[model samples]
Target: MTPDLAPQGALDRAWQRVADREAARLRDLFAAHPAPILPARAALARILAALILLGSAALTLLGLWLLLRALGLGGVSGGARVTSGLGAAPLLLFTWVARPRVPRVEGTPLPEAQAPQLHALVRRVGEAVGVTRPVHMVLSPDANAFMGLHGPRRTPVLGLGLALWYGLRPQERVALIAHELAHLKNGDPTRGGVVQAALNVLHQTVSVLWPDPVMEARAGLPEKLGNLILKGAALLPLGLIHLLLGLVGADQQAAEYRADLLAAQVAGSEAKAGLLDRLHMAHLLDSALHKQRHQPQRPDAFAEFRHMLDTLPPAQWAQVREEHARLRVRLDGSHPPTADRLRVVQAWPSEPLLTLSPEDAARLDAELQPFVAALEAAATEEYLYRTSG
Candidate 1:
């Protein structure tokens, strides 16, 4: 006998109701603006902020140099001189703050020779998006796909999420790739990196000035007061840096909206929208799976994901959507709400230029099978370790 899917049916109805209610507004917004345009003020603010940071660092170093020279002149008592030298400790903090650190990416590289068809697909997508192909492609365990610059040379690397790939349709996968490639075409990675570096400096400076209370608890009252004074002094620059980061983040969000439009152009609105929906559902299910005390052993991760999707009740899906709808975008967030993204894409006129045949999808999956198997094993082991701990 067929199992009851009344809950699932109800959830589908609920989703339709939500989609329908928001459809007109989405369409109108798209009609007014077919493509996202970066706000000029935000762009200017980002550039100005970068310049200010550079100037501030230079001024700080000059001040430290003058202070060291004055200390070397030694007009005061030895004890006073030692205290003056100690006063320069905050100057040393800038070195920690301004030090440039490369972003660490986790995953195993997939050689082009091992996946010729996949590489070809990426090349086609890159061409359509007017961006150079990534120098390397890596398979990640997370349910996400992104492109980034790595190392001193800032070489572009594409990261394909195994779980995301397994859960999405072939065309949807193409749309995901197109979206990431759009980031490269738009030069978001480089711009975002600069903003991120500035923010990191600000954050580290704040941490140094206002260390954990627990760590400083045993200090004398005078020492505590001095730390508090330092924290108060650091707040102004921190606030300014945060504001600047917000402006940069707005541009980043605009870039994301633009990428969605580009993805729709490459893979069609339906495919892009479908991919978003599946991703939302997958995230919900993945969270639940993560919380389970005893995970089911599955050799094929893709098949396991398929089974999870097939068996998930509609009521649970509806709950996930409802909760998702309640999420708000923060001022410093790089991406807009997924609902907004979905609405914008849905309003876009359908024009799919890429389609993969079932056989082609199967071939791609076959190539990824070994990698997926290894990823799943690692994920399982990690989960076991976490649960046991």
Candidate 2:
């Protein structure tokens, strides 16, 4: 990838121009496909309302039981208590079942001296931006680079991609690096990383507890007539799963937007515009189409559990092992719909884009302010949202 041989001040000015261009681009994007901010806000409000309602209901229930005992109208009912206890069992089971396991990705550091070209570029960029050089560079097939704070000091790791390395021009590569560094400057990664980790664990737990049969059995009880009213509490964990996922999706999108703005500012408007178009085009041609091509070989978690069970019996184990072998094929699934991504990029006002009238530009800018504000709000909430159980 080509590094900007220009002086640091020149790079900064170029970056600022790109940032302004990106702000305009985002404005156009918001105008073209207005995000349903009101609906999302209403949904968020509803969640808070539901939480309050749940607390009130719980308090009311407790009050009713206490009043009954004081009036001598009720006392211990063994059968009812037993049924309630049975219903509460699943809720207790879920506490443990829905917890996430941290994935053990071994930290692999690459030798820096081997890639003098990259080191020189990063060093220059870091010096210009007033940030530390990346602690390590990793080569992975995935189209991603993240900066995060880990351990006591919150060090940075600049993970690179083999695909990006081969595909992007040197200038574009510099743009990518700038984008990641922006994330560090904005403190998005360091602030939001812990929440992401927590949600991962929560998702894993919910996946275990919300199997079809268990969910079906959970729905059989009526709330008004029985002590086993909470039989359907499994739905709580399921709802949490969706909430966690939505938060992650929204945060990721905002993070990308911020990074785009920052990178464009760092690398210059021309480079940013070129890189955006190329990145979208590359994704459309390569990764976007191939996203869902590989699936895990096992049919489901059931198959994994059954295989484990069968291992206890030599006779059954062989059949189970064979089934596992046959199922080892991966299912390819597409990531988020490409149509949405295409729409977003097309809406961006890059260099070659059609010129807008002064009035049209003003209109688009006015429309974008709220979305930009919403993005900021989402960014603010991300840290708290991620860490909450």
Q: Which of the numbered candidates is closest to the native, going by highest lDDT? A: 1
lDDT of 2 at 148: 52
The residue ranges of model 2 lying beyond 4 angstroms of the native Cα positions read 1-108, 148-155, 189-194, 212-235, 244-252, 283-389
| Model 1, span 178-240: residue lDDT tens | 998888887662344556566656666666667578767877899888878988978976886
What local distance difference test score does each model get? 0.69, 0.44
RMSD each, Å: 7.9, 20.9
Residue by residue across 148-184, what tens digits does model 2's lDDT show? Answer: 5445454566766433433444455666777677666
lDDT of 2 at 339: 29
TM-score of each: 0.77, 0.44
Candidate 1 vs. true structure, TM-score: 0.77
